[model samples]
Target: MKRFIALIFALSLFPLSAHACGADTDCALGDRTYRIQMPDTAGDKPAALIFAHGYKGSARGTMRNKSLAALAERLGVALVAPDAIMDDWSIPNAPGQSTSPDVDEIAYFDALKEALISKHNIDPDRIVVAGFSAGGMMVWNLLCARPDDYAGFIPIAGTFWAPEPTSCDTPAANIIHIHGTSDTIVPLTGRPIAETHQGDVNKTVAMYIANGGYSASDSPDMTPDLSCESWRSEQEATMTKCLHDGGHSFKADHIKAAWKTLMSGN
Candidate 1:
């Protein structure tokens, strides 16, 4: 009896597994699912950053990226990584990845937003959405169509596909676009992927500027590794365009820097 009691005591010493629904566990809403990891340093009401994965990427993979997760932890924020459909977004006119009539990513995002606010208990006002490459283009679509859904937007290494959306809902949220000076994959000028050419970063930013009526800020970018310019609208929204010295890369540092600039107006 004493030996059995000792074994039970040893088991009890280890904390009970309440993590089935927590970090490392995938949370589902409808047919889609996402994973969330919270920072230990953040308070009870920490903000969230919903990061969309690149083409052929998964939420599990994004969550496993130590560099990105470390940045989220350092910022005292919750990191939410979402999965794309069939390893690629349902982009319009995207060759084999064309949008399905039944596939409504906007609807999925809408549900995810409400799920984050209600089920996940996140601060709706402090939520930001960001992505990389194809995911970055996804961010543009999300922010353009649902401007009020997130507090801020960050798109890295990608913009709209060719024949970009002519109009976007306004006033849009604060956005800080990050790219590389030597990016040949999704170059600053853009290149043909398969059947469609990528959208020009200048044109994409210009569309947002025209829609939001943002004014340029003469202040120089503070980060030495990046070249940045900023703009602001009367609605209190900020716009930023940033370029680094590398090529088609995903750096957590870049995301951190852009996040700071998006929050800090010129």
Candidate 2:
């Protein structure tokens, strides 16, 4: 989805199965709706990628990226993208506007994951979650709420507003944060969301590092187009931040880079 004014936003290969979905499907979670795609192989217990689209974007809008489809093929994981009720996520309360649904989004997400696991026999340990922009903020909230629920997290061009949680419910998972140095919408330096303030990208990373109990060490790995850095604590957790030259947009290369980095171990 293109970055339009207000809003913005997996891994693993399990075995091949005989009952995979060849195309996308319109799935429902009580009153909410989402789009899901299964691999051609009928691999039960396959890995899953749950994607949250940018604000005001639909599941179909997110799937239009093409890279996500390519990602499913590349990683052999089922792809699922859920739509937000108000075309905005329920992060911080926007002035004169409600970003998310009146319902419990956390519970919605939980049900979504459980539905996939039960229907497809997905591997709970291999489920990875990712979001962009507002969706990315959702990922941050998810991390704070259920850090142990996923194997990996990728928040692209995302941030959290003031009143964000200072700690997570459990140990953090492997995380890779990708952002653009030139983004003004959700700038790396941070911006105000309604009456609250979002932290800078660097500060956001530092917060995640602190939660994971990892200390910053070694200089950032640099390249012509990107600056990549990581904070690690032995085998406990690893967090990587990548800043590129693009604006607030999700490039195909970004998805590819995230998949490569997060799926490197499995």
Candidate 3:
């Protein structure tokens, strides 16, 4: 009788098992909601990957892409997809447009990271950031704002919006720029807005080169694959520019290749 009582007391003192939270319409951040998908496997600490959607896109937008989820599962990593505050993403305005300034996207990422850490046993060193289109721009900003928080970044169909007198205070984070040469929305040569134009792939690559201290003459030959395209970074830093043949759409093959590269460091 005493042993039974002691067993009951011991069980009461222990905490219950906590599971990874799934997509709940009730879970919201600012004016937006999130759809977080974690691996079903149970463990004390798991690597995590946070995904941001493009303009006018929801968490579901990226979640529907089975390839991303599959990669996360294979890697035993958690996947968190958060919605942007507004339907539009916060990107740099034209060269001299003073009326509209870039939104505080870094804050959103910080908040989301805090929430994830509080809820899960995530490995801080293995965190990865990935996004599409406008979301890609957000990823680039996050890399620049908080380079140490993430292991790497994967930006698709988006360029780094260069601020006037470009000043990136953070260190160079591993980056993979996946773009489409035929992208009409955010063209490789940049799109012409009212008076000024936004930065393009060339400008983005240049910024990375300048900030990352890479040699200009070391442009490697393009590696052409059936599903995607790739260019190796000249510097020792792990960076690459992948230009595919399709338009502004997410390709599963491209994502898979990117995932392999990201997880290879592990």
Candidate 4:
């Protein structure tokens, strides 16, 4: 974690990376590296979106695709895409597991935000954290574990892995989730494990709604389509589910819709 913090500090000093960094250099947070994508207009103090990639993926891979970058650009938001330690999502098998290589990912985010705040004109209250697949699981962990730090969350094809309802720390942030009903990697029905209990998309949504002080009857009305699917909450905090036609991989249209939802809140 210290190493990753040092890298992020270094990148903040010199914002530059070879590919995804564009003009900004890749920042290190322990053994991880991240890429930043800024909005076209300068001095706008735009809302920042921090992105976590899927299992075995890098920030560059997540941001390299034009469609994802287009969403950030269209929304006029800045993106911070970070690489996971060991090129994989952290899901230790043991209970009370110490983080691999002692990389405290939660703290890494704090440091990244500090650097971003110092270097960019960011709206602190509008910060959003987003992720895909295993990274989506990480997103939920952050929401439950570090609820006070962020305004909202976006998790794609991910599940909650808490052992019990009480284990799910109350989320002070709103959330939007995108999942495929047929996702094999992280099944829509969720998987059973020893250390923690994994939850389906619906369960996760319900949990978030309850945590956000919304009743079960307040669940959003769904608008399903061939290209996109949406569920909007009846409360101040909104939860949307984008049902992908296929499985596993992310759909650009759903991501675009998610971006639209985030921008709408702003």
Candidate number achieving the greatest TM-score relative to the actual structure:
1
* Model 3 residue 25 lDDT score: 33
Give the per-residue lDDT digits (tens) of candidate 1, residues 1-266.
99999999998885443235445777776878788887886666778888999888988899999998999998888899888867777766554565576777888888888877786678888888999998998898888899877888999998988788877998767888889989988998788867788899999898888888888865435467878888888887888888889988878877887676655643
* Model 1: how far residue 233 lies from native, Å: 1.1
Candidate 1: C-alpha lDDT: 0.82
Residue-by-residue lDDT tens digits, candidate 3, 142-252:
777786688788888876653322645455667777887678988887776676564667767667667766543322233354233233334344667777787887765
- TM value for model 1: 0.88
Rank ordering of all candidates by TM-score, starting from the highest: 1, 2, 3, 4
- Candidate lDDT scores, in order, read 0.82, 0.73, 0.67, 0.67
Better of 1 and 2 by TM-score: 1
How high is each candidate's TM-score? 0.88, 0.82, 0.76, 0.75
Off by over 4 Å in 4: 1-24, 29-32, 91-101, 162-167, 192-198, 216-235
Which tens-of-lDDT digit does each residue in 62-139 have in candidate 4?
A: 778687787788778887787776666564331234237466777777777886776666888778888888788878
* Worst 10 contiguous positions by lDDT, candidate 3: 226-235
Error of 1 at 241 (Å): 0.3
